[model samples]
Structure formats: structure tokens, C-alpha cells
Target chain A: MEFDLIERIRRHTEVNRDDVVEGIGDDAAIVAVPSGRELAIAVDTLVEGVHFPAGTAPADIGWKALAVNLSDLAAMGATPAWALLALTTPDGDEAFFDGLARGFAELATPYRLALVGGDTTRGPLTVTVAVHGFTAPGEALLRSGARVGDVVMVTGTLGDAAAGLRCLAEPDASAYAALVERLNRPTPRVSAGQALRGIATACIDVSDGLVADLGHICAASGVGADIDAEMLPRSSALLTHFADADALDFALAGGDDYELCFTVPADRAGEVGATLARLGCGAARVGRIVEDAGVRVFDARGNLYEPARAGWNHFAA
Target chain B: MEFDLIERIRRHTEVNRDDVVEGIGDDAAIVAVPSGRELAIAVDTLVEGVHFPAGTAPADIGWKALAVNLSDLAAMGATPAWALLALTTPDGDEAFFDGLARGFAELATPYRLALVGGDTTRGPLTVTVAVHGFTAPGEALLRSGARVGDVVMVTGTLGDAAAGLRCLAEPDASAYAALVERLNRPTPRVSAGQALRGIATACIDVSDGLVADLGHICAASGVGADIDAEMLPRSSALLTHFADADALDFALAGGDDYELCFTVPADRAGEVGATLARLGCGAARVGRIVEDAGVRVFDARGNLYEPARAGWNHFAA
Candidate 1:
């Protein structure tokens, strides 16, 4: 019975072309693009009740499913080229798949990424996007290049998503309305990531909080960090919603920020700052990579400060 | 809650320098390899109850999970290079992920594939693998090249998985032990797929039964098929466990066969047979691609036969 539905859905989508060396019927899809470019590949999965709240908008879910994957390519400073979507639907719903594809097509067109191939199977509502990009060899930005004394900067404001989540927990929370939008539709710092190809020493996104994600860089580059709480940016809405210290906590340790956190050497920091300023983006000297072993927090007067939990973890309470 | 476990598990695995330019600490892992080769990317998802039966052996589940994706690369005639795993597990029991990774690493080593990157989250039990392979440009086989009048060939015996599934439904039965293993641990026809890179016209794996998956090729290549039931090669275990007609039905449309089914030009059929023989594999011309509009199955005396249903569907009666 379910097989019949897949047959019908398979018929609606036609895979035919010379360049598509192989299509849906094979174990994997194959395509031939121009040679000589390095292939940039990234994979991301969205699990039900984890990535999104229960009963979230399916259309938004579809949009976000691909958007998050595209975000990874953006962080890597790669132009999106092609994508393979693996969708696991609870049950067979042609309408759901069509709706999901519509959401994907909406972004794929503007980004110039084609839906090359993928698979559909019975499972929980899980969507895995494996994206392929083409760039000149040795051009991708990585997270292993930060050095001591480098200035750490971020792309966007923090704690909006965390605040938005708070709003969801309690309805009619007019204080953080703007933060809700930030949480729902995060604009990936695609341009900024691409622009920092050679300038930034190391780069990572603030999906898992400013402090925790920075810890990733610290661990990888074998360095420590000294973050200034005073220099951290904040929104008026967030500040109004939470106490000064609480807002700072959210800014420092909130996950799902989806903003770019990067390290730039002091010598090249001015050039990067000026270039980013030209694009109407702002960066703060939030911290400096230290030769020490652990992350340290400092107040406006350079006094030591400590965070409650340091950050959020997906599996931890 | 789930994040700490992820951090702990991530620590146990060391990312080698050559395969991973930047390891697990970034937004998206960066991998640098040589150029001029096309990347073969395939994503597969295994749900809790849909893809695997309840209470499946954890090690076998892990092995089968990666095996299916590897099969996809095999179908495309690409050499496996790297894989990204997105795992969602219910809280507690560290052995679950550790065992899964152990199974994945064991198979990955022999194939020269490395676990490059992925995401770990807390949710329902789900494993989605995005496998990346590399092949010379224009070398991957596709399923849209089957010309009318091409001879339809299958690489190995069929219906073992379907038979194995039957044994699983009655686990107490002792007659078909090998069939159960065949169903659980399917060997993806890697060598045959690689060698047939330039030989076969259009190809696909027999996952959704022979008739249904073949229907995809027929629809894609703008051709139809006339398969002869008598020519289908089946294991002795399948024949012994089921009645003759039932065995034929399973052979005609059994999902999870994982064997390569493809079409070759009539003149090239001899070459395909010889190539498979040289590779120590079996290949039999089972039928011919027809000019008709749909798949038609016939017995030895040319009597048309219809299957009970096409194949498995996620959503169906």
C-alpha cells in the first residue's frame, strides 16, 4: 500500500538529463560537473522534538531543514551548488513532501543550488541535508588557525533565540518580540564568512552558545580565552526582558544564536573590522586568545567573573 | 542532558590529520583532498521501527545502517571516502552510541573511509548517514541510460532478504538460518558495481522489489520492461522455505534484495556476463527492456502474471 504511494510520488518527479549520469533508480545519484574545483560537502540533520519544538509549522520546519544545511556551507565560505535531501516521514504523505520540496525550492533557486538527488524512507520526522559546493582548492576557512593574542569577534547579537524561546514558554511576552523573529529566521552570515576567507585565523558558528562554541576553538587551537563581559553586545529588548546579569548570562551562554564567532590576529583585525564595517556589520573585541588553559571571564573593571553553567548542551540538563 | 554525552563520546575518537583538515569542533568539518575527482554523496536514514525491526541486535543494526549507504556508493560505482553520522538517542545507556560507532568504525577501516563529521542530538533513536565517495569524472553509473531493447540483468540471486524477513517474523523457525543472515547483513555488490562502471547502460539496486525498482528505471529511461520469471536466480534456502509460486512472487518483488539490477545493450550483454564472471560474480540476462509503456512479467510459456502489490511504502494500507 505504501509502495503504491511512493510509485506515484516518484512518477511526479522526473529525473532525466545527460548531465545526471544516474538518477533515482540507483543506490546513489550521480552527476557530472565541471572538473578542477574542490568539492565542499556538509551534512546536517533535524530531529523531531529536539531541533524544533513539537507541533512547529511544517513549512517552517521544511525551510529550516535546508536553511541550516545552507548555513554550514555559508560558514565554510562556500557557494552552495547541489544538495541531496534524505527525508524520513512518519507516514506517507505526498502533500507533506510536496510542501517540503516547495520550501526547499524557494531557497535553492536564489542560492543557485540544485536538488540533485536524495532518498525517502519511513521513519521519524528527520531531514538530513548533504550539500555539495565547488570552490578553488585550499580556500575553505577552518577552525584550527587561531593563535594566542588574537581578538575574538562575533557576527550578530546574541541571546535572541534564547529570549524567543522564553517568550514561547510564556505567551504575550511583548518584551522580546524582536528576539522571536531572530530565533525563527536566523540570517546566516554567508557574506561575512565568505569575506573572511584569508583574514580570520579561525571560525565557528555560535549555535551552541558564545562561550561553549568558543571553547571548541580554544580546544582545537590549543589556546585559552579571556572574554570581557562588558564588550559583549546586547539588544535593548533582551536587556529590558532580563536583569543586567541575566541578560549577560544569556548573551554569553545561550545556544542557538547561529551567529559567527571568529578569531582574527591583532595585525589583521583592523582590516577585517574595516571591511566588515563597510558591509554594515559590527564586530567587538569580545575576548582575546590567551596562552592559558581555560576560558576566563572579566568584568568592566577587569575583575574576575564566573558564569552559572558556562553553556547549554544538547544531551545535558 | 544529551550534549555532555556527545562531548564525552566525541573525545574517544581521534580524527586523523590526512582525512580531516579540521575535526569535530567546528560548525561544519573541513576536509581537504585531491582535486579532479567527482564526489559521490548519499544520505540514508534508519528509523526506530520502520527500517529495523524492534529489538534488533545493536551491532547488526549499526553494521546494516552503514552498509546500506555504502551500497548506494557501490551502486553509483564510487569509492567510499568519508561519512558523516547524525545520531539521535534516548537518554542514558552510553553503550548504545559506543556500540554503533564501533560497528561503523570497523567497516569504515577496511573500505578506507573515515568518519569525517556529524551532529549528535537527543531525540528518538535515529541514525542518518551522509556518505561521500570519489570517482573519476563521468565514471559513475546511472539508471536513466537504459535504452529500449537492452537486456535486463541482475548481479546475484534474489529474494533472500524477503525470505529472511519471513524467518524473522517466525524467529522460532529453524529451517532458514542463512536466509535470516542474508536479510540482516546484506553485502552490497561493490565489485560488480565498480567493474560495470562503463559497461552497464542503466542501473539500480533491488531495494524496492525487482518490479518496482525496475519501474523507476523504465519510467526514467522512457522505456518499459518484460521480465521472465523463470530466469530469476534464487537461493536454495528461499526455494526450500516457501512454495514455488510464493518464492517466485518474492523473487519478483522482494524489497531489501540490495543486488544490482541493470540494463545493457543487447550486443553488450555478452561483455557484461564475461565481466561479471571475471569478477567472480554472477550475472544473468533475465529479460529485455520493452517499447511498451509499463513493466510486464511473464512466465516461461509467456503467460502474464501480476504481483500482489508493488513493494513497501512508508504510508499505505
Candidate 2:
């Protein structure tokens, strides 16, 4: 039965790519990657309840699983090529498989990403996606290159997804369908990342909120950041639904937003914004890399503010 | 925190590979693949209580996880290079993390396979390993290359692992320590697989019993096979532990063995056996590919024989 589901997935996710020599149905997939280019590989796992909430649709679960991994590739300034999925389900239901496969393909098709192989096993619902992408040797972005005085920027709007999560907890959630969709199906900044390949000094996808993710770049680059909270780009919908304080909290430290929080030279920020704007993701200059030791946000009066939480920590009790 | 465990895992599993531009501790891993080789990728997932019995040591669980994926690379006649791990655990214990990392590194050190990237999530214990290896262009051993007149052979002994599982359930299983070791850790036939790359027409690793794995080859190659039951190889320990009929049944249909089952032209069977013997794994020619559509066996008296079960089915209740 698992094999049958995999067969159906193979048919739906198959892409006619010249580099793929052998796809699903083999012991291993064979691919001919172009030489001289560096491969960017990442793996991300989403548990049914931990990574996503209960009552989440199978299609959303599947899309988020792949999207998060793709986001990692995007942060590396790599163009995705192929992916392998390891899916463990409590019950191997056809309906669940169909919905998940459809969602996976829905995101994968736009990128021409081929589902080269996958394995389905019996267990609690969990989806692990491993993606392979490519970048020109010297152009691949890294989180360790942001020097002091560099600027930290983010793509697209923020806080919508986390606000969407909050909306789901209330009885009037249907009014926030757009926010719910953002929480469910995040748009990985693939094209924007590719455009920022040589321009961005450091890059990271914001899965664990702005402050926490920027902290990663800060830690990795041996620098710190100071951002103005008023400059955060929040969706009008997010602001309209939540109170100002909650909306600011969600925007500053709300995890689950799949936006790209990256660093570029302060002088190049303008052109970088133009490039991302051309890609349709729209970039925002939210902070400046500093010589300090941590990421700190300044309120309207330049006073330091603390969030309810730093970010999502997997093992935190 | 998961990062602390991942830090320890990173320290233990880190390998010095020039191909690895970045290994773990970044948004994504950057690897430089050498030109003139095709990449072979495979993933396998092992869930606690499903893939292995409860109370199995964490070290054994970790070793078996990577070993299973390495077996797939061996079947593809590819040289293992790098791997990514996605581990989900219910309780992130320090002891469990240490043991698992130790075991993973113990097996990985031999092949020089580097742990390039990984994600640790909070959930029921499950390990998903994605391995990448390489083979020369057009030299890959595939399951679809078997010819009607090809000779079918297998490496090492079969059914030991399955018998080992049975031994674990019995109180007097102490007498069968060797069998139990086989169940816990089956050696991947990597060297033997590489040796057969140019000579073997088709290849697959025996995971879900000899018959089931062989059936995979036949289905892919569009051919059938016939084997003599008496020609099947058996270990002295296995023979001593069980009745001849029970031993044969286990050899034919018992699963969990990580041996390599490959096909070669009848004319090259002798050289193939000699080459495998040089690798110390040895080989036995037990069958021949045929024009029929399904695999069948003949006993010593020329009577047809049927197994109690064809093989393990993941979703079969």
C-alpha cells in the first residue's frame, strides 16, 4: 500500500529534467549534476503537532515540509534542483497521501523541482524533506560574512503567519483566512535569494522569527544588530486583526515566518532592494549590523524592548 | 537544547573532506562534487517499535539507520561520500544522543562519509538518513539491466538477521549471540558492490527477504528467475541453531538481511564469484534469470516449493 502511494506520488511529482538519470523505483536515484557549481543541501523535519498545529490539513503539512527545506536552500543563494521525501504516517490513508502529494507538487512545480525519490514508513505523522540545489562557486551566500556596519534586510511582509497561528486559537478565525494561509503555505524566497547571490554578504531564512534568525547571522558573522521596531514590515491584515502590542510582538519575535533575513553592504542596500523588488518579494532594511554582541531592537523612543520569547527552540521545555 | 546535542553530534561526526565546503552549522550545507561522476542518492527511515523492537540500544539504532542507507548505495555500486540526518526524538536525553552519535561515527569513519547537514526535531524517535554516493557515468548497477539468461548471485549469508530477531525473543537466546549481532548490525557489502560494478548486469540489496528483493529486480528488468533450493548458501551457525526446513524457509523468505543480490551473464559467473571471494564476502550462484514472469524454486526431488510469506509489506497488517 505504501508502494502504491509512492507510485502515485512518482507520477505526479515527476519532472522531465535532463540531469536526472534514474528517478523513483530504484534503490537509489542517479543524477548528473553540472560540474564547477557547489551543491547546497538541507534537510528539515516537521512533526504533525510540534512543527505544525493539530487539525492542519495534510496538503498544508506537505507544502510546509518542502517549503521549509527549500527556504534553507534559498538562504544559501542556491537554485533548487531535486528533493527526496521521507514520510512516516500513523495510518497509510489514500486520502492523506493524495492531499500531501498534491501539496508537494503544487510548490515543486513552480520551481521545476523533481521529486527524485522518497520512502514511506509506518509511524506518527512526520515529514522530512531533503533538498539539493546549486550555486556558482563564489556566489553562494553564507551567514558568516556579515561584517560590522552591514545592513540587515528582510524580504516580503512579516508577522502574518504567527498572527495566523494566534487567529486559529480563537472562535473568529475564519475572518483571518489570508493570515491562516500564510501560516499554512509559506512562500519560500527562491528567486529573491538567487538574485542576492553575490550581493548579500550573509543570508538566513526566518523560520524562528526576525530577532532570533538575525541573531544567527550575528553570531555566525561575529557581529550584532540593532533594528528599529517601527521599520518592520507587517501586513495590513495582520495589523488590522491583532492589537498593536501583539502585532509588534509577533513581528519582532514571532516564529514561523518563512521570510529571508539577510545582510548586505550598507552602500549596496538600495540596489539590493531594487533587485528583490524586481523578483516581486520586496526587501526591507530593518537593521544595521553592529559591533555589539547580540540582536537588540529599539522602540520608537530608542529604548530596548524584550520579546515574550526569543524564538522557537526545539528542545526548550 | 537540541542545538547542544547537535553540537556534540557535529563534533563527533565531523570529517575532513575537501569536497565539503560547509558541513553542518549553517542554513544549508555547501558541497563541491567532483566532475565526471553521476550522483546516487537514497533515503531510508527507521521508526522505533516499527522498524526495530523497543528497548533496542540507541547505538545500534543509529548504526542500523546509516547502515541501511549505505546498503542502498552499495546496491547502486556507488562509493559513499556524504550524508544528511533528520532525527526526531521524544525525549532528548544526553546519554541517547552520545550513544547514537558514537555508533553513527563508528560506521561512518570506515567509509569516510561526512555528516554534512541535519535537523533534530521533537517527536517520536525516528531517524531518516539521506546518503549521496557516486559512480562513473554509465557504470552504475541498476535493477533494470538483468537479461533473461543472466546468472543470479548473492553476497554473504542470508536469513541470519531474521533468525537473530527470533533468537532475541527466546530466553535461551544467549547461545545465539552471533545471530543476535547479525540482527543488530548487518554489514553493508560496499566493497563487493564496487567490485561488481562493471561485471554485474543488475543489482539490488536484500532488505525485505531474498525473494522480495529478487522480485524487485525481476519486476524492473522485465524478466523472471528460477533457483535450486539446495544451492542456497547457509552458515554453519544458522544450520546448527535450527532444523534444515526451518533454516531453508528463513533463507528464502526471511527479511532484514543487508546482503547484495546481483545478476551477471552466465559466462562471467565464475569470475564474479572469484572477484567477490577476493573481497572476503564470497558469492554463491543460486539461480538463473529466465523468460518467465515470476520467480519459482525447485526442491531436490524436482518438486515446486512455495514460501510461507513472500516478504515484508510495510502497510500490510
Candidate 3:
């Protein structure tokens, strides 16, 4: 029965690529990478009650699964190529599989990412996606290259996904359709990441909120950052639904925002911003890299700011 | 807490290599694939009650997860290189993580496989591993290359894992230590697969029963196979633990063998067998590819044989 459901998924999400010598229906997938190109690989898993609410749609779960992995590839400035999915559901839920395949295809088709191979098994609702992308040797972005006096920037708006989740839990909070959409389906900044390939000193995706992910950059690059909290980009939808303090808090520490947060040399900040603007991403220079060794946030008055929670920690909960 | 567990895993299983531009602690891992080599990728998932018994040790679970994925790579005649693990536990179980990491390192160290990038989530007990290997371009052994008159073969003894599983269920069933070990830690036939690279026409790993997996080769290659039940190799451990009929049934239809089922041309069967023998894994000639398009088994009396179950079906249970 699981095999039959896998066949259903295979039919809905097949890609024909010359380089993919073998796609599905094999013990393993065989793909030819162009000469001199390095492979960038990432994997992410989403659980039912942990990553999403229990009543979330199957299609939304599928989209979020691939979206999170693609965000990782984007953070590395790699071109998406292939993906493998390991899906577990209660028994063989054919309807759920169909909906999930459609959702996966919705995100995968635009990137030209092929679903090469994977496994389907019986268990709690979970989706694990492993994405493979290509980058020119020595060109992929890393979190360990941030230098002192660099400018910190972020693409898209923050706190929308977290706000969306709040709205999902409390429908009376606000009925902002756009925020809900952002929560259900994130737009991975693939093109913007490619645009910043040579410009950004270090990069990471804002998965565990802006502050925590940026802290990763500081730790890896042996540098620190000071963020101007007032400079954080906020969408009109977020402002309409949330008050200033709540929205700022969510933007600072709430997780599940699949936006790219990166650092660029102070001299190249304009070029990076202009490039992202041309791509229609419109990044914001929210902070600056410092010589200190941890992330610090300051309000508009230059006073240190703290939040109730830094970000989502799986075990801390 | 998840991050701390990941740190422990990183410390326990770190592979330092010049080719690995980046390893763990990154959003994605960057590895240089040598020029002129194609990558072979495969993924497998194991669930608590579905894939194994509930009380199985954490170390064994980790070993089996990586071993199954390596088996897929072995079936393609690919040399193991890197792997990504997505582990979901009910909570951040530190002891379980340590035991699992140790078990994973045991199998990974021999192949020099690096633990690259992955995600740790909070959910039911699940382990999903995606492995990446390298093979010479156009040299991967696929399941769609078997030809008529080719000799069907398998590496290692059959029925040991199945018989061992029985022993696990009923501890009173003949105390065969080897059988229990085979069920808990099935060795992946990587060396034998490499040895059969040019000699075998087609290949697949026996994760499902021999009949089911061989049937896959037949369906892919548009051919049939006829196996002689008497020719099936039975380990002394399996034979001592099970009666003749039960042992034969287990060999034919019981799963989890992790042996390579392949086909070599009739003229080169002797050469292929000699190569595997040199690799310390003897080959068994239990069947032959035919012009028909389904797998059939014949008993010693020359009559057709059928078992109660062809193999495990995840959803059927």
C-alpha cells in the first residue's frame, strides 16, 4: 500500500532532465554534476505539532517542508537542483499524499528542482526534505566570513510568519490573509542570494528568528553585531495587525521567518542593496558588524533592548 | 537543547577532510565532487514501531538507519562519501543521542563517510538518513540492465536476518547469537558491490525479500527469473534456529537481508563469483534470467512454490 502511494506521488512529481540519468524507480538516484562545481547539500525535518499546528493542511505542510530546505540552499547562495523527500504519515493516507505532492510540486516546479528519490513509511505525520544544489568552487556563501565593520542586511520583512501563526491560533486576533499566506508558504530568496554571492561577507537564513540566526554568524565568524531594532523592515500587513511593541518583539525573536540575513563589507553595502533592489527584494540595512562577540540590540534611543524569548528552541520547550 | 545535542553528535562523529569545505554547524554542507564523477544519492527512513520493535536499543537504531541507506548506495556500486541525518525524538534525549551517534560512527568510520548537515526535531522517534556517494560517470549498476541468459546471484547468506528477527520476537527460539546479530546489525555488502561493478549486468539490494527485490529487476529489465529453491544459501545459524520449511520460507520472502541481488552474463558468472570470493563474500547462483516477465520459484520436486508473504508492506500492518 505504501508502494502504491509512492507511485501516486511519483506520477505527480516527476521531472525530465538530461543530467538526471536516473530519477525515481531506482535504488538510488544518479545525477551528473558539471565539472568543477561543488555540491551544496541540506536537510530539514518538520513535525506535526512542533513545526506546524495539528490541523494544518497537508498541502501547506508539504510546501513548508521543501520551502525550509530551499531556504537553506538560498542561504548558501547555491542554485537549487534536486531534492529527496522522506515522508511519514499514519498508515497510507492516499488523500494526504496527493495533497502533499501537489504542494511540493507547487514550490519545486518554479525552481526546476527535481524530486529525484526518497522513501515513504508509516509513522506520525512528518516530512523530511534533503536538497542538493550547485555552486562554483569557492563561491558559495559561508557564515564564517563576516569581518568587523561590515554592514548587516536582511531581505523581505520579518515577524510576518510568526504573526501569521499567532493569527492561526487565535482567529479573533486579526484576519490578515497575506500574513497567513506568508506563514503557510515562504518565498525563499534564491535570486537575491545569487545576487549577493560576491557581495555578502557572510550569510544565513532567518529560520530561528533574526537575532538567533545572526548570532550564529557572529559565533562562526568570530565577530559581533549591533542591530538598530527600529530599522527592522515591517510589512503593512504586520503593522495593521500588530501593535508596535508586539510586532517588534516578534520581529526580533519569534522564529519561522525564511528570510535571508547577511553581512556585507561597509564599502559594498550600497552595491548589495542596489542589486537586491533590482531583483525587487529590497533589503534593509538593519545593523552593523562589530568586534564584540555576541548579538546586541538597541532601541532608537540607543538603549539596550531585551526580549522575553530569543527564538524557538526545540528542547527548551 | 537540540543545538547542544547536535554539538555532541558533531564532536562524536567529525571527519576532517580537505575536500570538505564546510561540514556540520552550517546551514548546508559544501563538498567538492571530483571532476568527471557523478553523484549517487539515496535516502531511507526508520520509525519506532514500524521499522523496528519498540524496545530496540538506540545504538542499533542508528546503525540500521545508516546501514540501510549505505545498502542503497552499494546496490548502485557507488563509493560512500557523505551523509545527512534527520533525527526526531519525543524530546531531546541526550543519552539516546550519544548512543545513536556512537552507533552511526561505528559504520561510518570504516568507509570514511562524513557526517555533513542535518536537522534535529521534536517528534516521534524517527531517523531519516540521506547518503551521497560518488561513482564514475555512466558506470552505476542499475536494475534495468539484466538480460536474458544472465545468471542471477546474491552475496552473503540469506534468511539469517529474518530468522534473527524471529529470535528477537521469541527469545526462547534457539539461542543463536549470530542470527540475532544479523537481525540487529546487518552488514552492507559494499565491497562485494564494488567487486561486481563491471561484471554484473544489473543489481539491487535485498531490503525487501529476495523474490520481491528480484522481481523489481525483472520488471525493470523486461525479463523473468526462475529460481531453484534448493540452491538458496542458508546460514548455519539460520538452519539451526529454524526448521527446513520455515528456513526456506524466510530465505525466499522474509526481508531485511541487506544482501546485493545482481545478475551477471552466463559466460562471466565464474569470473564474478571469483571476484566476490576474493572480497571475502561468497556469491550464490540461485536463479537465472529468462525471457518471460515475472519471478517464479521451483521447489526441489520441480513444482512451483509460493510463500505466505512475499515481503513486508509498511501500510499492510
Best by lDDT: 2
A1-317: candidate 2 lDDT, tens digit per residue:
54577788777787889999998888999998887788999999999878888778988988999999999999998999999999998887888888898899899998999998889998899999999999888788888999998988999998898888878878888999999999899999999889897789999999888998898898999999999998899999998888888888888888788899999899999999898898888999998999998999998899998877778652241
What are the clashing pairs of model 2? Answer: none
DockQ of each: 0.54, 0.91, 0.90
Q: Tell me the tens digit of each residue's lDDT in model 3 across B1-317.
A: 55577778777778876678888888899998877888999999999887778887888888999999999999999999999999998867678899999988889989999998878888899999999988998789999999999999999888888777777767474577788778778899998878888889999999888999999999999999999999998998888767999999888888888999999999998888888888887898999999988999999999999976777553242
> What level of docking quality does candidate 1 show?
medium
Please estimate how well model 1 matches the true structure, expressed as its whole-model Cα lDDT.
0.74
Candidates 1 and 2 compared: the better one by TM-score is: 2
Docking class of 3: high
Which whole-number lDDT from 0 to 100 does residue B47 have in model 1? 77
Q: What is each predicted model's overall lDDT from 0 to 1? A: 0.74, 0.88, 0.88
Residue B296 alpha-carbon offset, candidate 1, angstroms: 1.2
Candidate 3 lDDT at B226 equals 98
Minimum summed lDDT over a 10-residue window in model 2 chain B is located at B308-317
**Ranking of all candidate structures by their lDDT, best first:** 2, 3, 1
